[model samples]
Target: MEKVELLEAVQKEEENIIRWRRHFHRYPEVGFEVENTANYIAEHLEEWGLEVAKNVGRTGVVGFLKGGEGKTIALRADMDALPITETKETDYQSENIGKMHACAHDGHMAILLGVAKVMAFHRKFLKGSIKFIFQPAEEGPSPGGAAPMIDESVLEGVDYIFGAHLHSLYPVGTAGINLTNMMASTDNFSIEMIGKGGHAGLPHESIDAIALVFRMYQEIQLMVSRNNDPLEPLVISVGTVNGGVATNVIADKAVLTGTVRTQSKNIREKIIQQLEDKANFISESEGGRCNVQIERGLPPLVNHESSSLMVKNAATKVLGKEKVFILEKPNMGAEDFAYYLEEVPGAFYWIGAGNKEKGMDYVMHHPQFDFDEKALINGTKIFIQTLMDVWN
Candidate 1:
């Protein structure tokens, strides 16, 4: 089918897509706990007569559609929500307390379901097969969801993969395409300081674990600034610190939890080692014991050159050339889709969902984040056009 015709078809089904998205948004779940979401997706796919696989990688749902069959292409969508509570006063505001679809995974799922509908109807005309991936926990409770899905063999036999995220940074009706790195690698670390506790009034009697914790935090900042290359971008953020039962007592133990982000694997590894070493040295000098735990999370998301070119060409064929913008720099945000890219050649891109006039300009994961409904049609058209282009 032609691009305009495919877009028109998606437009006709806009009401159903919105209905599905709101239903998902009303009952959001976090991380690997997406039981209802997975069931809903599997139910719909089964109704569409596609081969459905449930629980591929802990609540992940996969669907398969076969046609003339040259090579298989995978279309992926994340199926997890954030832990933020909804503050937006809409008819479909989240019904579950302390959980919300603030990151637009609801929109991503809707777009993929729309693609399934269109592709299912026109399966006879397809030159190859299509795999629909409903991935759980892109936002990650720890290492991330993509690695688990990859371990489950989700990318096997897949020639190319495609995925997209809703972005509030760009204006509505616009899309971003990148040929190189699109996002950074994320790693987490925790430092624990152990020392003797005593009365605050007697400074000499206490080992002062709090003091050591502060010193370690400060030294980490210096390491990022002075030790690393000035041209490279690196960030070390200490998000949480807990210690001390009372203000009058010196804490016996202190815990520090934080995140580190880097663009390259080598930089990430070096920063991690330096962080551990600095923490241990500072604690030892202060007469305290130190323990550091470093956990590697998702790798940087790098879009292949040829795959990105295919995405751009498909987008241009669907929407005009004026609507597609090539990104200049990689974002520091992390995506679990990087795991899939590690196994196969693929492209992940951004679909604009910001419109100030409609009060939809809030960033992803914000309490009041929302997307323009027009983005649903735009995303659906792009996926359909891209699949047809790739197979042809």
Candidate 2:
């Protein structure tokens, strides 16, 4: 199909796509607890006469559409929501309390479903198999959802893969593509400071954990500034701190949790080691004990140049060349889609979701975050057109 025809076809299904997106949005599930979302994906794919597989990587659904001889391609969409209260007072606001589609995974699933419907209808024109992956837990669960899905052989025989993120940072109808390092690596760390407790009035009798924590936080900033290279992009954020039970008593223990983001693996490693060493040294010197736990998260998303070129070409053919935006710098946010790219050579691009006039400018993961619904149709069309461009 021609680009216009493809977009028109997707536009024709706009209402149905909206219905799917809203339904999933209302019943938002977090992490690996996406049973209803998985069921809905499976039913839709099966209804379209595609072979559906469930229970892969726990609550993940995979649908396959086979065609004549060629390379196999896989398209992925995350189905997990965030653990946040819905603040967007829309008719389709999340019905589940303390859970919401704050990250726009509902739209992601709908776009992939829209593409699956198009691929099913045009299966005869396809020269290769297309796998639609509805993955769970992209947000985080220790090792994340991508590695488990891959370990379950979700990418078997898959030669290439494609995925897209709805970015609130960009305007609707515009797409962003990067040829290398589109996102950073994320790792988390926690520190527990153990000290002696006594009356707050008796300072010399007890080790002051609150004072120690404040010093530790400041020292961490200094460590990054002095130890890391001036040219490297690195960030250390201490987000949570908890201690003390009562105002009259000096806290016996303090807990601190934070995250580190870096552009390269070498810097990531250096930051982690420095964090541990600094925390340990400070706590011991203060006559207190410290335990640090560092958990590794997703690696940086490196976009393959060839795959990105293919995506740009396909997108230009579908949308106008002027619609595509070449990003100058990678965002510090991390994605588990990097795991899929580790096994298969592919690129992950962003679809713009910002529209100031429509009041859709909230950043992702915010309680009031929302996107322009028109991006759904545009994303679906681009995916279908890219498949045709790649397969033909």
Best by TM-score: 1
User: What's the lDDT of the predicted structure labeled candidate 2?
Assistant: 0.88
Q: After superposing candidate 2, which stretches have Cα over 4 Å from the reference?
A: 1-8, 195-212, 242-252, 286-288
- Per-residue lDDT of 244-341 in model 2, one digit per residue for the tens? 99999999899899999987888888888887887788778878888899988889888888989888887777668898988878889899999999
lDDT of 1 by residue, 53-161 (tens): 9998888999999877577999999999998988999999999989999888999999999999877876665789899999998888877677777889988889999
Q: Which regions of candidate 1 deviate over 4 angstroms? A: 1-7, 196-207, 243-252
RMSD to the native, candidate 2? 2.6
